[model samples]
Target: MFEALARFAVRFRWLIVVAWVAGVAGAVVGLPSLSSVIQTNNAQFLSASAPSRQAADLAAPFQGASPAATAIIVASRTDGPLTAADDAAFSRVLLAAATITDVTSVRDQGTSADGQAHRALIVTVPNGPGNAPNARLVTAVRDTFAAASAPAGLTFHLTGPLAQTADADTASTQTGDNIRKFTLLFVIVLLFVVYRSLLAPLVTLIPPVLALLLAGPVIGQAGQAGLPVSPAIQQLLVVLLLGAGTDYGLFLVFRMREEIRRGRQPREALIAAMGRVGESITFSAITVIAALACLAAASFGLYRGLGPGLAIALAVMLLAALTLLPALLAIAGRALFWPTRPAAGQQSIGMWGRIAAGAIRRPIPVLVAGVLLFGGLTAGLNGFTTSGFTSSSPATASDSAAGSAVVAIHFPSPTSNGEILLFRFADPVWHNPDALQQAHQRLLTAAPVSALTGPLNPNGTTITAADITRLYASLGPTGSLPPTPPAGITPSLYQTYRATAQFISPDGRTARFDAIPAAGPAGSRAAIDAIPTLRTTVADIATAVAATDSGVAGVDATAYDIYTTSTNDLARLIPIVLLVIAILLAVLLRSLIAPIYLIVTVGLSYLAALGFASIVFVHHGHSDGLNFIIPILLFIFAMALGEDYNILLMARVREEAHRYPLHEALTRAVARTGGTITAAGLILAGTFTVLAIAGNNTQAHQLGYTVAFAVVLDTFFVRTLLVPASAVLLGRYNWWPSTLSRTRTTDTPPTSPQHGPPSPPHARRARL
Candidate 1:
């Protein structure tokens, strides 16, 4: 099948090339921009049934109090408490801030309880989703604050959800360009080092570039078809295509060059090379696609789109590898390696050959040592901690992070992020003082609650029913009270009742409270961990209040949901992914045993990769933990990619074993495919390393580093040593239940270098 396809590709090379170009161009022109359709909000990526989503639904009708965009301005005294003069300056800054365009309303949240340290201003503005503040508004707010006069000790910082969204978006955008440039440079440099030719690297680079150009349209179309593509996944498409495309291209091109060196004509070499290596490339692509497609079963919306999105990317890469890459090699001919013609018999299998030979000689030791090494690496799993969807400290040098630092130091709340708990009773309770006090106490004492604000009088003070009634009556139906207080009502009591109105529904049955965490940043482990306790306490409190419904909904809750869903997705999808790979391997190898062991080796490689990443990023780089998304992504990329090399080596082993004894076949297959697999691994690893360094987002960096490290481990250790050794030990059983295992060796001896090409029947029969 591959021989026929290769012939068609080379026979009408120009037509094949032209068709690919036209298809790619048409797709590029027809598809929409991926960014336009990408979802940046974490909430949008949650499953409809996620607890956070449920809470959001319950609170949606009552969410108008918090503006879509807000700029939180925190001011502090550098030396001491704010003096009278500094307070005057703060007032002027607040007034100036209000006049800025798009500024809806500005409120002074008041001074810190200590009175010696901090004061804050909250400014609301019209903005887009994801809390992305309007740039113009941000600039205006900052400028207004800057112009204000203040005492020597006073300092101001600007940070909030709005500023964070803007900074994060900028970092991701800038990082995308950096990743592209770095990947291209790495590919060129590595290919030059490997092939030792100027033309070869350039030729090898075309398929990946073509694949990248083709991906935009494919992703756009998928998005149009209702697939939810996140900005993160959109960025990932390019990296995967470049990395995987280069791998397949390397496999085919190196094999073609080897055939040419063996005295075949360029066209014959191309066809023969494709015929030989094509199965590996095809099977590897299928393995990757299968693993990714399993993500479709993910409960999280983020992962559901990811599985199919990556699968589509791998498919395009496979097509380019088979068709366009062959056409390019056919056209380039021997000149593809120009300026560096090689001497005869100079083929270098290098250390891989040595490793394969050692494995064949001492299979048990090699197998045992490999298992021990893998087990050692898996030990790092104990240190693994889920960070959920928490945002890290801003990666970019932005004002938002700077402002958040000052806020954390000076504000009453320990962190800048806040959580809101919502409750609704079967009975109206907002007017009932006892019910309000009971609910407030429940939230106040909840675990991780450092501070709590309730729906009744904000200050801890006493007020009778008669005082409240007079205040309400005086306030009238419009929520506006007479300027003069009623004779019996205190002014403070009237002001408190007015401020509490926003927390209650007009019907007075539902109420909301804001809670601040005891410690940690918004998305940090501490804050996310506090959510369950908060929810349980709130639920019990709601029952005590005879409320019909209650839930915690805020930044912490969202982060918690993201973690829970990600964990659930991992649990459910991993078994399915392994099963899919096993099934695919079984069908391809025609041996149940080979598939079983191959998957085991891949699994070990995956754990080792994660352990290695943890060592580097956690122990050395001093990260809190591996990013939440990295584990599953590592399993998917490492195992599937490890299988890529496994399929290439084992498929060749299966082919050669038919003619040669098991041990000889294993050694020869290792020697023959070693250089190409190594080259592919180097290129793919280099690309991911480039991404690790250039990826601007925190998670991207983590993913890049993790995958790059794992690919190298899988390539150098698992594929090179463990797989070949185990296969040698397994012998003919490697092809159990298949004709290849049962078939007898032919009477003809193995072909020599002087024997020329074997008969087509022999080649075909060997592959079967």
Candidate 2:
């Protein structure tokens, strides 16, 4: 099959080149403008039934009149009560901001508990579903706010989703620039070392660069088509395409060169190399695609959005490797290795070869050592803890150390619980005389409430006239409270409330309960589990509210709904991915035994990677835990890449076994392909390590370190030592009941034979 492919590629090399050119041109012409949004859509991030989503739905109507951005009011006074002059100046600043095109309203002003610190203004911007807060508007607001001269001894601080998103975007852009610059340098230097030829390394990098170019436009179109792409997907695509794409390209070229060294013509050598390596490449690509596709099953939109893009990128890379790469090699001919000639009578026994030799000499020792090393890394899993959105933001340095510090000092808790609970009043009952009063009573009495407001509506039928109206009004035009709600109701009521209930329907048919976990940061773990407890409380409140003849229906049960749903989806998807990988390996290897061993080795490598990541980021790296999404993402990438090495080593062993005994074949295969596999592994590892330079944020750092370490271990220990050792141990059984054994037996040479070429008499005598 590979020979035929190689022949076709050589015959139609120009056609392939032309097709690529046309494809690139078409993609460029058809590319859509890239636009992205950074909003915390609870349903998108969490689960459909999450309290946050429920609350959002209930609050929807009220929110329509409110600003999308949170307003942070800072008031620092040097002395007595704030003067009228201060109030007048602040009001002018806020009112001026309200006139901006995107600004919805600005309000909330009062005095703080200390009297010396007075409450200032909060400006709200319109944020509607599907409509992101305008960056220009946000910047305008910030600039306007900053320019406002506060009366002497007053300072202001701004912190909200809008500000955070802007900061994160800026940080990500800078990080991307750094990554692009550093990665270019890294790839160039590393490729040179591996190929030992500047031209060869440059040639090797082409496929990946082309793949990335193609992937970008395609992903842009996907995004426009409503395929929920997260901005982070772009970064992942770049890293994977470069790393995995280069690895594949190098593997094929190296094998082709090896074949050429054995005296075959360039065309025949390319054919033989493809024939031997093509299936492995296809299988490896399938593994990666399948793993990424599994993410589609994730409950979070982020994962679901990323899955298709990654799968498409991997598939394109695979096709390029099989078709375009072969064509390129065929065209280059003997000069592909220019400036360096194939050494005469030279037997290359590189570092990997020596390592394999040692492993072969002491298989058990090698296996034991490898297992123990991996086991120790896995132990770090104990310290792992999950973090929130702030932790994921690239709002600070390469590692986001400064951002993390800021969060710790000023916002030691989850920035906002992002949890919501919804209530819907049965239609007919909403008009009932007692409906509004009863609902307010239930909300006030709810177990989670630290404070309560509303039942302020006199009519009690219309949503705007209900108790929620007073609450919204108190939050002011910016949706934030004054230091204290006018005397009778302290402004702290909104902030202290476990759940802020609001009516959404104009007819008073629906209401929302927004809740913050009372347990705080130290309580996240317990809170994550106790969602059921919160749900029960919510249910009880709903029942009480409904009894008023208002027919209030529970829209959301608890914050736990989001967490549990995602956790469940992750649990289900992981096994499905593993099963798919195993089946693919089985079919590719055409042997159940080989597939089982391969899958086990890959699984162990994944666990080891996760464990090691946990140690560095959680224990030594001092992070709360690896990013919540890291395990799944790592599993997919690691397993896919691991399969690449498995295919390379196993294919070589199978081919060599056709001539030599199983033990000797294993040794020969390891020696011959070890260098290529090692080089490929190191290149892939180095590409991931670039993330370690991401600074502050541990997500990139942990992921980069884990993958890089896993690849190294896989190449050196698992592929080089364990695989060859096991293959040697398996002996003839490795071939099973196949014709491979039959062909070997039938092709055996006679005991005695005359040489084709004449040798010196003395040399012939010495050999005899």
Q: Rate the local accuracy (lDDT) of all candidates.
A: 0.73, 0.61
lDDT of 2 by residue, 76-105 (tens): 445565566666556656666777775554
Candidate 1 residue lDDT tens string, 610-716: 88778777887787778888888889998898899988888888876766667666777787778888888888888888887877666878888788888888888
CA displacement after TM-score superposition, residue 681 of candidate 2 (Å) = 1.1
Worst 10 contiguous positions by lDDT, candidate 1: 746-755
Q: In model 1, where do residues sit more than 4 Å from their true spots? A: 15-29, 61-163, 342-351, 392-396, 402-415, 426-430, 446-448, 456-472, 476-509, 517-527, 619-622, 744-768
